[model samples]
Target: MLYWWSKFVLLGPLLRLLCRPTIEGVDRIPESGGAILASNHLAVVDSFFLPLLVPRRITFLAKREYFTEPGAIGWAKKQFFTGVGQVPVDRSGGSAAQAAMSTAVRLLREEKLLGIYPEGTRSPDGRLYKGKTGVARMALEAEVPVIPVAMIGTDKVNPIGSRMWRPHHVHIKVGEPLDFSRYEGMAGDRFIERSMTDEIMYSLMELSGQTYVDLYAASVKEKAAAAEREAARSDARDAARVPGTRAG
Candidate 1:
């Protein structure tokens, strides 16, 4: 109820008018039954635009922090996320990851559309990154089809680190569902999971036309951060070597 209200009544109209969003292969989406919409993460608005354009309600599993912040503004954010069909899950990994998987499987079994970013996080440089195997595990465990979705032009509309969205056209490309029924009941097999995940990532790569990077996005971001820190340290050392420079 709230989801529809937010979509049609509040945010959806404004987004539609500004971005003039377009979607291809939307008919590929199942009219009923559970299925996984595996998408390439581009920008924060990727979540907003995909669901806004899709006919059925798409529920995403977001990190718990979005719902746990303190104060009235936090409460408002929590309400907004909830109304937009996002469910908060612990993303800290280990047991928390297993719990999230369980929640996702449960949702799928209930015949709901579940949106997942197989890369685990947004791409740092707009290239498609290797997908995490959790998406494979969920599809196999829930016995659902995985549909590769590509969100285009969303980064332009809402680029990384931007507080406001620009009026840019957005497009969504939906690919044919990849059936992993061949690997049914083999959810925990690492080798099978890797193969399935790779296949899904390949579909995303083809659909989005983005360069496919075999490395994980999170790892690349970590390496870049480490490099930046090292450079900063080197700069500090060079500054200290200057004769009149004072150490703070």
Candidate 2:
């Protein structure tokens, strides 16, 4: 099939040769059955590299945009992502989030390994951020264990705004599966969801050795962009106040 061909015949072999990723504690991943691989998102390649290295096929709930890009490059990207089993998720409306949760639970029921980034977005500053409780809810509903995975050096391999990938050696560390069976049938409890998500984040913090921020990564990125825009506006105002300076 396309997945095997891409893994063994096409992209997977090339990436392994190029990046030379190092993996640790891969045995922690369950040999069979449904489970959640909860990882810290670092770079865009974090999704690509983990699936390439792990023995089991991973299906990440990726954004719909990745699959909807236009032109030849977009077509190729769509092929690669689909070939590797990444599912498209729409994150626009309130119903979208609920729909994604439903999709994840269905995948688990079908006994597929699902990959989720509890933080909801890539770390803007290399520090782990507070996780969205959706992951905890899915785990509770699915009755599956959550395995914590830390991807190191991927940020360097393909850092923000870099089109070219460098041959940096990446490391993957897998921790034991976290069991939340004690909270079974408590899916709608906000307090239990928060406690479970916090515990999972703590495990990732220990595994990745990144500073833990209590704020969400997406919020941090937004604030940073807003600050940058404000600074630019302030500079423009200062320039306009200067005598003989044009606002162009």
Clash pairs, candidate 1, are none
Model 2: per-residue Cα lDDT over 1-248, one tens digit each: 89888777887777888888889999999888999999999999998888888999998998899899999999998998898879998988699989999999999988899999999988887899999999999999999999999999999988888899889899999998999999988999999999999999999999999999999899999999999999989988998999999555
- Tell how far residue 211 is off in model 2, in angstroms: 1.3
Worst 10 residues of 1 by lDDT: 239-248
Name the regions of candidate 1 deviating beyond 4 angstroms: none
lDDT of 1 by residue, 159-206 (tens): 888999999999999999999999988989999999999999999999
Overall lDDT per candidate, in order of appearance: 0.95, 0.92
TM-score of each: 0.97, 0.96
